[model samples]
Target chain A: MREDASISINEIQEQIIREMARLDDWMEKYEYLIDLGRDLPPMETALRRDEYSIAGCQSQVWLMPRMRDGRMNYVADSDAKITRGIIALVLRVLNNQPPRDIAAAELYFLDRTGLRSNLSPSRANGLAAIVKQMKAAAAARMNT
Target chain B: MVFTGTTYKKINTAQVLDVDKVRKDFPILARRVNGRPLIYLDNAATCQKPRAVVKRIVDFYTRNNSNIHRGVHALSERASGEFEAARETVRQFLNARSTREIVFTQGTTDAINLVADSFGADFLSKGDEIIVSGMEHHSNVLPWQRICARRQAALKVLPCEHNGRLRVEDLDRLITENTKLIALVYVSNVLGVRNPVEEVIRRARARGVPVLLDGAQAVAHFEVDVRALDCDFFAFSGHKLYADTGIGVLYGKEQWLRILPPYRTGGGMVQSVGPERVRYAGLPLKFEAGTMHVAGALSLEEAIHYLRKLGFDSVRAHQRRLMDYAEGRLRALDGVTVYASPSRRYGAVSFTIDGVHPYDAGLILDKLGIAVRSGTHCAEPLMRKYGVGGMVRASFALYNTRDEVDALIEGIRRVQELCGECKSTRSLQ
Candidate 1:
């Protein structure tokens, strides 16, 4: 978890949008996202249980959450590269944030950057499922 | 493009029907998508409706739109007549013994559930086995699973080869005294392989077990005769046959329809509901509860008529040519791997490319105005068997053209070029 950094979800979302906007084409943007996925930290094999998996995703995605210093820290991975990329974008906004902030945060960067509409129905569904699982994990930790 | 030689002619033996004329029937085919001409190769999902079917639906809504079988009004009588006439069309389409055997449901899924629920409730008992192929779609498998769970019956799978062909030779060992029914897919939507349903049916008949064939993919391209097949039950959806989405047909033998209870008991399915006791309506009507999709049934009849006009011989020939072209194109691609080289395959052609996800391939194809189906295709078990996450499937119909197949090839090449860097140079083996 990056304890030194504390940026609002909106600011992080804008940063992502700005980075994505630098790319001229959809292919370039997708390639950048795939690279981000490749560079993202791999989830621990021990944490990859079925309970942590998100349903309704076209790809098999696992999300494991941990409470580190009152903030929700998540580790995620997916079988498909594009899905992994989408999940990486999702994790960037919500990871290492306070449980309440994570749960309440409306991650609108995907829609603002035109990623949501440009995505195929199943891809959009996979992204939504990942977001839902992340929020649910945050909410669960908050409750506990 | 040189389609010369007897081999080509032998493959498409049916007289060359005017494809350009057939293409004109579908208005949507002329339109463009994503700045490119729309090349629809997703026929396995649902076929595009011709002008005839569309005009029939519009005409029904404009003139004779009324609830069937209840009212005394002229519109109701006309609608009732049309709906029953549609039933007769389906009866003739499948060459069923009688109209009394045909029951309309929401679609193939609904039809399968009707049989699985009603038949399982009536006949299935504890420890009884319902045999289904591994290649069966979730629709055919899930309903039976639910019913088996409820009735303490076991749902046994008839295993298929890695290429998705079921081994009917193992039928002797698989079917036991406890086996009640054998359910199979007449044509696999994924592999596009026509299963040895006749052999399976003969085997089941020997064991005195009734067989149910999911003919959702078969009815459009092949000549489906329920009487000739002698299968106990056959189910298919209208949408895949170029008809409306919400309409489907379930054809059961009279003996079984009489023996099995009603799937859903309601107003239309009752003889007389008195205070003391109620008697169910006979045969087909007993299965069709409440208000049916009257307009959909009529439109389905039009779709059937359109298909009949084209004739199955030309339709089959056209489909075979498309599949052959598609298979050849896919096999020629460096990274592309075609799945299930079944002997008697038609219509659908599924493949995977190195270092590209099926969804990614499908997305790129969509951008190029080539629509194809990606992912498990409702056959998750088959995916698991093949050890692939998902596959991109480009299916054909009578309406699909050689030019469209060329566009699909170009689209795939574009996908490869775009995602080339991301692809690992590792061996697939």
Candidate 2:
């Protein structure tokens, strides 16, 4: 799939939901996620420090955000593959989008993929934290 | 199905538990998680409550619900009688000298905090030392840490061995004249190793230092005789013993409870309160303040009765078989590291798989309807000592079976396979 700036956040989310719908069971869905996580570009080692880490996650997650040409770009990584995969999915929808779009975007694709359970606040898997951090970062950029 | 009257008699006669029969008593066991039969291996977190316990709670709320120790009416007197009777049950359960020794609290954490606050305030002074083990759950560690900070006392630690044993031999050097209290876990929640607490208690006694055993993990697996152990203090949670949450026991010696001032003060805990000064109530009531968890206490009593009916011999034997099978099966698997494979283990077996994070394994296991605990299991210091971020723990209970262990083993293999495929396919990509 091309990283097209022309695609809207909802369109990408729909695309993700449609892609996830093709998987028959949780195993296949997880496998697809694992592949996505494995393919994600590694975050710069210097940026993966304690300051970038999210608290309350069972796995160690580091999320770093940058603004490029009035758009948000997030570089995130997790020690756990499943969490990394979940973050990869989140970034797929929001990455390179305008800060306003990123901030206001509703992540319905996570629920559609049957992966929302992992994003529960009680689960503390870092997906929820990642999404919150991404939006908060975008909102912060909008003020500047 | 209420295991109240005749069912007790039936269970007492049977030497070993009918495992299936025992499993039936816990309603949650029959339910499915995800799409498969639930394999609950997280008993160390909290055991499933039996029907008798639930019924006891409901029965109390339905009929004998009233403020205890205050009311002169029929319901109040009945409620107070049953509440004190629950204390007596706990007293008998731990074989304490009197009901005076059994003080109720919210749970193990609350009990420990009670002791730390009361005892530390009364006994500890600047430069006085308190000893705790490296493997203690944060509950055991944090209370003493706070108290020590307040008292300006030193907190000494008995380091855990590489193989997961507390270094008991170091107690002589650690237990100086300045040592006020030695708090330790009776069972390691992470390693499953039952610490050599008896020897530590004996050694501490000789040195005139009081010892507190955090028996939160111990009480559920075996019988605890406070008199036999001769420890100054023992703390355990009711929920871990198949009873309700929000109730626990802090068994103190008569001498200790007599001197340790009240932890919380309120309406129920006072003999009289005047404008100028106040007089505290005696013994157990001094510690129990306000309207207690009357239902929780009553349910705990029923849970004890239920356990006594099943018999500790049976519980021990069954748990032993499951642990042995689980340890054997887990040890057989390649690329798995079982922490603290001590000669004596109880309740939980914690480990990690190579190239697979414990969190990921837990996620997959949850999907398969096999519940497990991952991450540090609330013992981060121990995890740091072992040089791991987290571990997968499968903790067993009386209702848990060899079949569940088999399921856990299979589930672990599935985790390894799924995570392994991700790596292999990634290498190809």
DockQ of 1: 0.28
Query: Which residue pairs in candidate 2 have backbone atoms (N, alpha carbon, C) closer than 3 angstroms, thus clashing?
Result: none
The CAPRI category of model 1 is acceptable
TM-score of each: 0.91, 0.95
Q: What does candidate 1's lDDT look like per residue over A1-144, in tens digits? A: 545667978789999888887876666666666676776787877877888876443566788778898888888887666667777888888877889888888878888776776444544235566677778878888866
Off by over 4 Å in 1: A1-7, A67-72, A96-104, A118-125, A136-144, B1-14, B421-429
Docking band of candidate 2: acceptable
Worst 10 residues of 1 chain A by lDDT: A118-127
Looking at candidate 2, what is the lDDT of residue A48?
83
lDDT of 1 by residue, B369-410 (tens): 889998889999989998998899999888887777878888
Write model 2 residue lDDT over B36-143, tens digit each, in one string.
899999999999999999999999999999999998999999999999999999999999999999999999999999999999998999999999999999999999
Best-performing candidate as measured by DockQ: 2
